[model samples]
Target: MLDIKQIREATDFVRERLASRGGGEESLVDEVLELDERRRRLLAEVEALKAERNRVSKEIGRLLAEGKREEAEARKRETRSLGDRIAELDRQVGEVEAAREALMLRMPNLPHESVPVGRSAEENVVVRVFGEPARHAFGPKTHVELCERLGLVDFARAAKVSGSGFALYTGRGARLERALIQFMLDLHTREHGYTEVWPPLMVGPACLEGVGQFPKFKDQYYGVAEGDDPSNLGRLYLIPTAETVVANLHREEILREGDLPIRYCAYTPCFRGEAGAAGVGTRGLIRMHQFDKVELIQVVRPEDGYEAHEAMVRHAERVLQLLGLHYRVVLLCTGDLGFASAKTYDLEVWAPGQGTYLEVSSVSNCEEFQARRMRLRYKDCQGVNRHPHVLNGSGTALARLYVALVETYQQADGSVLIPEAVRPYFGEERITP
Candidate 1:
């Protein structure tokens, strides 16, 4: 959410941002300003009427005490009228405020100045590329092919159980997933200063609203009904990101000044309904309805969010660097950025089998957009309450990273060489069936 004062004063700045997004450019700003104006005016009017009613009620009490019965009755009648008017205006104010908030929630975050101006990922500039994609002397195998031959994954059975875009890991595949989770958690908690947390996979609508996922990605989530009524189902949704839970842990609470920067990391299986996508490219574990991810979230002072964002990106890079994976970092163009992210950096890993780079993680700085919606705040040294800046990034996505690992480390004998980092977990240097 943007500061109301900033929206009013920086209307042109916000307008430019919406324009760059390529659609819905002209109407949103004007509609928001109009609704806000009406809300403020109604509130002022209602406050004045309440004040008048209070004054008259007291006068009526004094009049009755002085034995002025007729005057007191007249005052009572006037107070009753004021009460009715106040009630009507109160309802109007509520409606206007609700309308204003609806508009505000849909407004996208302002892009950072450094973000490239473009319409799609094709326009995104690669800031840096690491080691080259591993070369194969023979025909390279895709993740699906490698997993099937190695008895690591069962897709046909998974589809029978839960439809497409789901995978059933077997044998070493299950162990590999667990090993990756442990590897990432250990790295972040021990070396990165992030506290490990286990958060709920199912969350309430209010929590989604805080993270800017409710309105934007509603269709993509799996909503669960909350109410007991047969007709009026109370709905809940599976989390699409652990940040939705981590960022809202301190919602509506005021943290002490000493805890200026709170960092958290969690391993959770994210669920997303890739509704419209189907067929070839999404083959294998690349586009799954369920996938495990280790997420990193930080709550910091507003002034330090940008610096913190860069540091978080480095933490993500550290994971790839340690695993000996070849990848590249790209700055997401403004038009290609997520709705809530003012700026984003995507890390793409080279997949030899696919013959292309696949995105493995995205790190973003949301500034105060998420904190404002979550009502997350902290008390500064001066005893001032203010919203803390929030940032979240995928330290690494398990499934996509596996695509890079299997293809890059494949040997002539069909054995997979486990990275030195993961060797301790498997109790062997290579995965052989």
Candidate 2:
């Protein structure tokens, strides 16, 4: 959630940045300001009424002590009316506050000033490219074709068992998935300075809200609603990413100034309701309702956020680098930035068979947007509590990374050669037909 005070103080600035997001978001700031004014006005009225009631009660007491019974009764009646007025104003204040909060929750974070102003992915700027897309003497086979010929993933049965947008890996495929997860987790924790955490896959609504996933993107998640379900967590939602859980580890917390930067890496089976674009090139591991991902999270001092963002981009890029995959880092413009992120960088790996660059990870700097929602604060050197900047990235999402790996390494013999970096973890050099 954005700081209301920021909007109140910098209305035009916030509106202009939000306008760059291209959603008529300037109007949202106006609404928030209007509601804020009403809420404050109501609160002021309630305070005045309360004060008047107190003064009247004191006068009533004095009148009774002076034996002016009639005067005391009149003042006592005035106090009653003042109390009733205060109650009504208090109720109005609560309603207005709720309306303001709802709007705040729905508002996207203001785009960082440095972000390029654009309208979509087409306008995203490619910051750097690593290696070139390969050419195959024999026509390249898609990951789907590769998986089928090699008997790796059982997509047909995944549909039978759980319907579409799901996959069940067998033998080498399952092993490969596990190896990728372990590889990324180890890389992030052992080298990237991130602490490993295993958070609950199912989380409460507040957890989703704290991470800016609720109210707006609720349709993209799986959940158990409130009722007599007999579940320990009556109302719960399965996390869409480990970021959703790991970032909340310090939710509603106040940290020491020395612990300015907190890094965490977690591996989780993320469940989603929305599959990606439909039809061609969307088959196989390119899009799945349930997929494995190793997520990276960092909370740092406000000033260090951009530095952390750059380092996070490097960390994610290293994974693809070690795997020897050809990929590019694209800096997202304001229009393409995630809801909670002030800025983001997407890593797209070239899938020769798929004949496209598949996004394998998105490293985002959310600034203090999420910390404000989570009420996560850290005491500064001045002993002032302030929201710390938060960052999250897919150390890499596995499905498409899996697709890129197989499609890029497929041999004419209908087998997939495991990348050398993952060879030891996969326990084999190739998945032979």
| Best of the candidates, TM-score | 1
lDDT of 1 by residue, 23-69 (tens): 56435888889988888898899899999999999999999999999
TM-scores of the models, in the order given: 0.96, 0.95
Candidate 2 residues 1-433, lDDT tens each? 9999999998889989998988776788888999999998888888888888888888998999999999999998888888888888888888999999999999999999889999988989999999988777799999988888788899888888888788899988999999999999899988988889998999889989998988888878887765756564438888889988899999999999799789999999999888344742345787788899999999999999999999999999999999999999999998888899999999999999989999999999999999999999999989899999999999999899999999999888888889999998999999998
CA RMSD for every model?
1.9, 2.2
Error of 2 at 169 (Å): 0.4
Give per-residue lDDT, candidate 1, residue 71. Answer: 99
Q: Which pairs of residues have clashing backbones in candidate 2? A: none
